[model samples]
Target: MKKILNPCFLAGIIAVFSLTACRDDKMEETTPDQVQTANAKPEQPNPSEKSCSYVDSNWSWSAVLINTLPTTTDTNFMNSQMVNIAKMWGKSTPTLLFVNDPVSPGSTYNAASYKTGYRIYYGYAIYNDAKAKGGDIVNAMILAHEYGHQLQYAYNLPTVKENTGRSIDLEADGFAGYYLRRPNGYNKTDFSQIAAAYEFAQSIGDYQTTNPGHHGTPAQRRSAVRLGFLIGQYDVTAKDFDTTFFAYYNGVLDGSLKMVDNTIRPEIKAYLDQYVDELKKIQSGEISAEEFKNLK
Candidate 1:
């Protein structure tokens, strides 16, 4: 049976998920002077260019090439996705980069967003892994999540009130979820696909409570994505979605709201309930990195 979430309970879930944030060590903060001083010359991609090319020099956003992918096909796919995302915000396309490795080894399992461009370091490796595990939809989710970061950068959102980066991370996750459910976005009408992609998000959750870069516990991350997916059910623009999400996110963070239990879809509720205790422990700093790593 379909479950209905109580408004207050839903608010609390969003609150917990939104409270955490992450720091992208790889993302360089561009200064006002840098943005202002950027060259005005338009550097368009050559029609024959197969690899990365310039999108906008004013923002210093450019597409870059990496040696890991079979062809420009993957990169092209990402560019198209970015274009779709950009259109939602009424912004120009950001640059794309396909890189072989991240500065931090083994981190290629993830993607990072930069003011200059979005980097899919280890693109082929991550794509192949996600494809094997959950099909191409997983790949779409990853791109959507990273693009969520770009949205944050574009909107200067979250209006943070805490010392951590969790708010930004959660909001980005929410944005990705929102996009995936949109008709013009991933058009993933099946909730099962979202559930499958969410596993990837859960896998990346960390137990670094004191770390300013902490993304959130597995449960919190899972809930955040789910909340975003639910919010997308409504007809709203990207800006309106952001505004509504933050209102709920901040309401919970400030204690102006409380959690209440309501029926949840059996499949999703069962999946999330399994990690409730673990998430509680994570938020309380009772879970260690070893334990977090071993969580299934």
Candidate 2:
């Protein structure tokens, strides 16, 4: 484990498999329904819950699943990402849980963050699926997004409240976007790479907007992340991120955010003015994915 100064925040990523503080079985029981914020929430461990086993498979996601502890390189890579993201949001690293049961896979297709456990869970299956769908950076995006929920739980955020599933999930999506570009995070200086990583966000999108767990449509998610990436250009605190994101959430979704007037800091507005129309196109699907990726 990479040493951290904060005892309260010294979440042992090794705990999921080897430690005893957090219970992997119980966490899986709390898995958030299709709706709800925080990547994937967990449940109390119920022994009666269904379970399965894993081995080499013809299936795609299992292709990468050796279902063993990650190698030193893999652990270091995740530690760095967690450190960067924690630094970016001004929070401590939460415990990291690897939710793969080499014996019996309890939760294989989800990821989540929990106020209860003070950590994030990344299922091996979902990680591989993300790689198969959108490459490794997408997992970075996922990790960042889950940590974003940690921010919310810590901050009581998103000043704009819709009281719906989308509000929470979409804002987390925005946070992921911000992390992807921040110097301390992924440092994605190129818009093309950032834009191309949209597949994972879009892939998780659902049509059940009224569902308590509806995250957001694919188009809305794409636009939310795009707006967050644009906001990453500024050096802002966690509170500042929430303010700006909520301030423009509507405009980003409908493409109505304009630079014509006051309220927004002039420098930030100037930076974002160029993307207003394109934001509209993305959210509305007026622009194809190819076109979005081609953006400079």
* Candidate closest to the true structure, highest TM-score: 2
Residue-level lDDT tens digits of model 1 in 204-287: 666665666666556556556655776666656555556555544532232232223243334434544444454456444465
lDDT of 2 by residue, 81-168 (tens): 8788898777777877555543223234556677665777666656555566777688788888878878877888666666456777
Q: Quote the lDDT for 238 in model 1.
A: 55
Worst 10 residues of 2 by lDDT: 1-10
Give TM-scores for every candidate, taking all chains together and pairing residue i with residue i.
0.60, 0.77
- Against the reference, the lDDT scores of all candidates come to 0.51, 0.63
Query: Model 2, stretches more than 4 Å misplaced?
Result: 1-69, 102-106, 258-263
Candidate 1 backbone collisions, by pair: 20-166, 20-167, 21-165, 21-166, 22-165
Candidate 1 wrongly placed segments (more than 4 Å): 1-27, 30-68, 71-73, 102-107, 117-122, 250-296
lDDT of 1 at 45: 39
Tell me how far the alpha carbon of residue 81 in candidate 1 is from the true structure, in angstroms, after superposition.
2.2
TM-score of candidate 2 versus the correct structure, residues matched by position: 0.77
